[model samples]
Target: MTALVEMKDLKKTYKMGETYVKALDGINLTIKKDEFVSIVGPSGSGKSTLMNMIGCLDALDEGTYFLEGTDVSELSSSKLALIRSKKIGFIFQGFNLLSKLTALENVEMPLIYQNYSHKNRKKKAIEALEKVGLGDRLHHKPTELSGGQQQRVAIARALVADPPIILADEPTGNLDSKSGKEIMDMLVDLHKQGNTIILITHDTYIANTARRKIVLKDGKITEDVEVS
Candidate 1:
């Protein structure tokens, strides 16, 4: 299988007046197409930093990152933005939905960036919502839905673009056990449909749900193992 994401000698640093902090230090990793992988680490372990690099949300100080065979680290800002819009979908722990927009409208937001026609955006958004089992909640606002439902809407928004890779950051952090399980199940179903899924979380049990686990500590990967 082709590598969906590839990082080599990745390094990120932040200046703190007198000293510098390494968010990611000499990290190398690869995630292949249609693989479900989890990145687990304690707080400040640089997992989030790695996610930012993989998602093309931030630039690294050193190393090369290739997304779908394109060297993203060398791309211009405009090109990077285009890659983000077209190649990656992000799911956040906070559910990141606008309070005022209905679920359907929220899902349609990404399509607007792609300059899709209104009718086409609505059609794609409806299909995404239905795929996540939110067909009946399309008209409801985020506040009107439960925590799980709101997250479902977020998932719908992520999938609406039909991106090849899904990057989820702490996707189940705020939900109850039942809801978290449901969300994980939904993600598993998505992986089964041939999407590459990279999940970032601090929870071991949650990380185990993926077929492969990468453990990070102090800006380095300490373990990369395949689960049964």
Candidate 2:
């Protein structure tokens, strides 16, 4: 498998008042194309920090990060944003949908930044929504949908741009067990269909849904294993 993401000697620190917290301590990781991997850890274990670094949402204090062979660790914010928009799709636990926009509009948000025509954006958004089994709810607002449906919208939004990597941060955290299971199934199907999925979650069951599990603790990775 070709390497899609590579990190070496990654480090990050935060100043908490009079104290310094080592959020990430000399981390090194590599994720390959078409792989489904879960990063699991308890609270304050640096999972979120690592996610931010991988997603290009935050800069690391010291390290080299290569995404698709391009160095992204030292890029300017605008450059990083461009890289993120083109290569990475993000799904958050909160569903992050705009309350006033309908599902179709929300899914079209990413393309709007890329100078997509209105017709093209609408067409792609509809296709993505259909992929996530939300075609019938395209015009519904987030408030009108259930938590699961809202998450489907989020997934559609992430997929509409056809990004190479999907960064799902606790995607099922806000749903009931049944809904969460459905979301996990969708993610698994996505992985099979060639999307490189990086799932960040603390739930053991959710972590195991991926083919590979990476455990983090005290700002370091303690275990990296493949599941059968």
Best by TM-score: 2
**How many pairs in model 2 have backbone atoms within 3 A of each other, for residues 3 or more apart or on separate chains, i.e. clashes?**
0
Q: In angstroms, give how far residue 171 of model 1 lies from its true place.
A: 0.5
Candidate 2 residues 16-60, lDDT tens each?
A: 999999999989999999989999999899999999999999988
lDDT, candidate 2, equals: 0.94
Candidate 1: segments with Cα more than 4 A from true spot? none
Q: Residue-wise lDDT of candidate 1 within 40-94, one digit each (tens)?
A: 9999999998999998999989998889899998898988888888888899999
TM-score of 1: 0.97
For candidate 2, report its TM-score: 0.98
Which pairs, if any, clash in model 1? Answer: none
Relative to the true structure, how large is the alpha-carbon lDDT of every model? Answer: 0.93, 0.94
lDDT over C-alpha atoms for residue 66 of model 2: 92
In order of appearance, the predictions have TM-scores of: 0.97, 0.98
Give candidate 2 misplaced runs (Cα > 4 Å): none
